[model samples]
Target: MMKQIEIRYATDADAVSLSKLIQRTILASNSKDYSHESLDLLCSIYGPEQVAERIKNEHILLCFEGVNPIGAAGLRGDYLRSVFVEPFHQGQGLGKLLVGEIEEIARQKSVSCLMVHSSITARRFYRALGFNVVKYQSSPEGPTILMSKSLS
Candidate 1:
């Protein structure tokens, strides 16, 4: 049977789990969309120090099935920083659910705009969700798109 999942606002205690989720998901799946060096850099950014800083400044949501973390999302003001779901758990609608959860938070906060630096793999998903590509930029890591959706 498929595991039941839940989404909840991340607390300070969740920093480690959230960091692991981001690192594990990226290492297992997103490597194809990013170079090894870039992936490594991203993983390093999830170290305890960085996670602690982000936790204090941004809103994070953690996805779990019971006590096991399956995904995570981070929002820094108007920017959607990261959205990652374990490969085994992808395509089961959790991604959309997480995005919706973020939007709900934004609505309550009265944020009228949402933006993300989208990976190649996620551009289509964001597009389908009503975000448009405002521009494409080349990064030393690879290619990325600046995407935005107006909340109004």
Candidate 2:
């Protein structure tokens, strides 16, 4: 049976756990497509400092399997920023749960539009969540998809 999980609002105190989740998610999720150096660079650019800022101004959600965190997500105003699930916990509907929570946060914030710069590896997940692709391009971070969803 699948273990129970909790979806809770995250605080600055939860940043470290969230950060580790992000790193673990990246290492496992994209190991087939990303070099170790590339993944390290990506995490460093979007690590604890970025997470701290999200905790300060964004609606951060930390998904826990008991005291251990299994996934993480958040919205910066109308922008869905982070969506990560620990490798062991992927494909178990956790990613969908996190995105749903972020969408709820956006609705509560009166956001009629949602946006995200989704990584190439994550485009399908967001697409499955109803975000429509507006464009695709290369970035210093690698290829990306600029996507949006109407909440109105």
Candidate 3:
């Protein structure tokens, strides 16, 4: 039997779990492409409190497999603030699922375009999802690729 997957709007109660999920996903999946200093900065950006706040103020979503969170994504205004999947869940299409959902949410909000500052490890993934590179940018976490997709 296959496990059922569910995606839903994240709540403040999900902050700790989501934070841990994001941190684990970054450390496990992006470590090869990002330096330790960059990883530390990325991990610090989504601490539990910060995640809770984002969930409250932004449209953040989480994906669950049998009551355990396996992936998450956040949208702030027209921008894709974050996307992460558990290392074990990578390549299972969960990332695509989250992105699809985010696009739908943006559509509902009448957002014409959605943007993302994708980590180098995820640039190809976003590109495969129809996002085009806008530019290369630097963040405190280090270099990032700016990508966007039109919702119209």
Per-residue lDDT of candidate 2, residues 74-110 (tens digit): 8887788878888988888999988887888788889
RMSD of each: 1.5, 1.5, 1.1
lDDT of 1 by residue, 7-109 (tens): 7877778778778887888788778889899888878988767887888888888889989678777788898876888888888878888888898888788
Looking at model 3, the pairs that clash are none
Q: How many residue pairs clash in each candidate?
A: 0, 0, 0
lDDT accuracy of residue 73 in candidate 2: 80
Lowest lDDT sum, 10 consecutive residues, model 3, at: 1-10
List runs of model 2 lying over 4 Å from the truth.
Answer: none
Per-candidate Cα lDDT values, in order, are 0.84, 0.83, 0.90
Q: How close is candidate 3 to the true structure, as a TM-score?
A: 0.96
Q: What's the residue-level lDDT of 27 in candidate 1?
A: 88
All candidates in order of TM-score, best leading? 3, 1, 2
